[model samples]
Target: MWLSPALLLLCLSGSLSLTGPSSVTGTLGGSLSVQCQYEEEYQSYKKYWCRGQNEGTCDNIVETQGEAKEKNGRVSIRDHADRLTFIVTMENLTADDAGSYWCRVRKTWYLGFWSSGTSVQVKVSVSPEKAMMFLSSSSSVHLLLLVFLKLPLFLTLVGAVLWVNRPLKGPGGSQPDKEKPSRSAPSPGKPCPGIQPFRPDRRDLQTLDSRAGGQQSLDSGGT
Candidate 1:
């Protein structure tokens, strides 16, 4: 009798609830291992590691009976009856090897008929060379962004410094020349050619006379 997909899943979930990591990740050409545990009653069953396919079928990789260790090309399986657990190890992993895997058990029951025991899903992830390339590209982009962010501030500071130390202008908005003073200019004792000396007006004379009269009265009072 062939078991339906739903029936198989129900039997697997009800008979044995396998416990292990949901996913495993590894680098290119690296190795990884996973462990699955079952109840003590299923200790005598054959434990197997299989890769999942899209057509609802599992491709068998390695299997063991009772308590034994078996190794294939790059896959290995170990069944421990004493601890009621099985371990699957894969080495020299590549990107193509990344996919869904299953930890399955098989047993004989009901007079020479084989029964599917239980299975648990395990997802494997492998990082190829492209992942490293992506990281390198991301770092370069971040560096460019950092420079772009700081460039304006740097330019602004440079402009401010240049402006602060810029050459000063004279009163007519032009830079003053650095020529020496001309010898033909008049000295302090001689007057400028276009200027004239001052002469007192009538109001200045009247103020001077009043100040002299006050001095004379003070002198008389002292005498």
Candidate 2:
């Protein structure tokens, strides 16, 4: 892969350690403020804040020059020396307020382009009553699925395991009779229906040798 000179400079600049609040907790229908600070030494730069409204919608809250016009002093941007930080406070936050936010350096660069910032996710939650109710509803759904969905799969696996290990047995729900020989019922020179035919014994090896004039000896009473 080939990278342009600008992207190469971006990589050399290292991971953008976005200066922002380490963490934030807020309640719904309330006010919340998110702050970001930059650490690079850039002569002339500006701050911009945009909220991820949806898939492609970015609500611009502040731009360096026109920052005051968009937001009623609820937002402030500062870019001096090596720091570019801003604070955006939103009053009467709603459920739709939860989203990602970004701060970027808006100025001409050697690569002749503006670099947009990395994001911080803004989260909103309600107090005990609503939070508890939401958690309880989630747990109930999980429990219902456990009782109805996973149980069937577990039972099927257990049943399959039990069925495969059983021993094979004789026909007619009975064992083959051990008291009487089964092959005796088959006609001579015909293979037995229920048993495998036996192979010749190794004692026949002597008979094969005797046909070539091998002598048989009788034991003497006195030697």
Candidate 3:
């Protein structure tokens, strides 16, 4: 007398087959859309979007039975026979909208008890808060991404600096300089490289030698 959930779903899918994304996500205060595809034979049949876990007992939110496009408050349904698909759009999403939804078609009754035909289950997830501005602006998005990517390197450099400046526990108890000065002072008694030493001319040395020879001759003659 009672049919299981899986058998009921199988019976509903026999008449018409529907295909769509199993799950979708949207941010708070935003909009999301679901596209359902069906066979050409059922494209002319009425299509409806419902909200609930069970397709038979789900509450109908919007249907395209009378018009090609039907809208009910925040939800809208549109059927395109040429494309053999139906699209459901929901705007101003809130936390309450996050739940199981169904895209189904109105077909002949099965065993004089079932009413809906083909169906597909879709799960909607709504974010708790609106997305940040960085998600919308290209520059801001790239900047935030770059910061996240470079965070580890930045932390590593900070830690290295702290480790290098840590106090020494020996005699001085002072942290040593990480880098030494480029220029060092000259050592004592060493000439500072660029100056040249002085030297006497060759002509002065020759004149002194001649004077010494003449004095020696005069002393020998007097003796």
Candidate 4:
């Protein structure tokens, strides 16, 4: 059985234990650094940072040629042979910088060349101001929704209070008015009616009794 170069690289990568974060989060306009540690056997190999694409392939971004430190534009790499580790730094991050990357070691045997190591997914988040604005807008929307949800209940409670305090009505379906005492006319130059109001009549008593009986009979008939 013979193994192809790509398959051999995959098998080697699975066997090698590289230490680093599986995913990294960064903020826009900020910078981030990651450390990848390899085995002692790969200390003499060239260390590389690459942007991973489909099918286990990557585009090389930067490499350290056994140098202590190297930089390219916004990317910097530091090789530490004593520690068996390499540090990669990316500055002035943006949304477009978010993607999958690999910290790899290049190895060339007698017949083929390949890279093997671990990968990290980098995610660049939105700016702080934009995040805060989104949160503020969401809070305002929730507040308005709460007010709208409670408005009908508030109106119903007010209506119930008004209904409870409404004025009492008479049998004719109209609010009754306070009654004023009646006054009689004065005799010609004799005395005011307020002073000569003591008069008892049998006919008036009879008329009241007849009106009371008539009211009772009408009420019973209606019931």
Worst 10 residues of 1 by lDDT: 11-20
lDDT by residue for model 1 (1-223), tens: 9999998888767445667788999878879999999887677778889988531389888999557679999999998778888999999988899999888876667875756567778899998765787799999998897788778788889999999999999998999888967668788878888889778999999999999999999999999
Cα lDDT listed for each candidate: 0.83, 0.59, 0.84, 0.76
lDDT tens digits, residues 1-223, model 2? 9999999887555335455654455565467676776555432455567666441256766666533334644454544433355566666655655556655544454687644444444443433345676889999999999989999889999999989986656887776665774445667888877788877677887776776453333223233
In candidate 3, where is summed lDDT lowest over 10 consecutive residues? 128-137
TM-score, each model? 0.51, 0.39, 0.53, 0.48
Measured with C-alpha atoms, the lDDT of residue 21 in candidate 1 is 81
Write out the backbone clash pairs for model 1: none
Candidate 4: segments with Cα more than 4 A from true spot:
1-15, 111-223
Q: Report the C-alpha lDDT of model 3 over 1-223, residue by residue, as the tens digit.
A: 9999999877776534888899999889999999999987686788989999897789999999644688999999999888888999999999999999999877766665856478888999998546654355767767887788777788989999999997765457765676767776778876676867666799988998999999999999999
Worst 10 residues of 2 by lDDT: 214-223
Q: How well does model 1 score by local distance difference test?
A: 0.83
- Pick the winner on TM-score between candidates 1 and 2: 1
| lDDT score of residue 217 within candidate 1 | 100
Clashes of 1: 0
Predicted structure with the largest TM-score when compared to the true one:
3
Q: What is the lDDT for 76 in model 2?
A: 45
Please tell me which model should have the higher lDDT, number 1 or number 4. Answer: 1
Residue 10 lDDT (model 1): 83
